[model samples]
Target: AQSVTQLDSHVSVSEGTPVLLRCNYSSSYSPSLFWYVQHPNKGLQLLLKYTSAATLVKGINGFEAEFKKSETSFHLTKPSAHMSDAAEYFCVVIGFSGTYKYIFGTGTRLKVLA
Candidate 1:
């Protein structure tokens, strides 16, 4: 089975500070990893993904994540947090179970404080 876990349910950060969203995944086979962001009442946006490419993947809005197969982790990070960055982030995984199935994490709500 494949699953994803968002380490923090909620994260509060002041504007201009660094941001970190932790995620860990478990899979029986090599999997495709992804990060998505969702604003209130808005559809999900693709942040980044890892699929046997460079371990360090960059995304929009100065966000990036490193895929570590050994650690079973894909943690998102940014040098500084912006007010607009406040949203719900999700970690997703697609296991090679002969079909396309997305395993979504519970989610991590990021609060950008002034």
Candidate 2:
């Protein structure tokens, strides 16, 4: 079975502080991991993806993640959190079989305090 768990349901940070959101995944096969950000009513934007290629992946808006095969974890981080960065983040994993489907983690809502 394939599944993803976000360690935190919500994260609060001051305007210029660092941001960290944790995620863990389990898959039956090689997994393609992804981080997606969703603003209020907007659609999801791809933050980063770890194809079988890179263990350390960088994404847009100063976000990045490191894939740990042994720990089965892929955590998202940013050096600084901006007010504009407040949003909902979803950890996703695409099945290795190329099924074009995704398994989404519950979600982590990020609040950037001004």
Write the residue-wise lDDT of candidate 1 on 1-114 in tens digits: 999999999999999999999999998888799999999999999999999889999999899999999999999999999999999999999965687888899999999999
Model 1 RMSD, rounded to 1 decimal: 1.0
Global local distance difference test of model 1: 0.95
**Residue pairs in collision within model 2:** none
Off by over 4 Å in 1: 96-98
Model number with the top TM-score: 1
- lDDT digits (tens) for residues 52-96 of candidate 2: 998999999999999999999999999999999999999998754
Error of 1 at 1 (Å): 1.0
The whole-model lDDT of each prediction reads: 0.95, 0.94
Cα shift from native, residue 17, model 1 (Å):
0.5
lDDT of 1 at 39: 99
Q: Indicate which candidate wins on lDDT.
A: 1
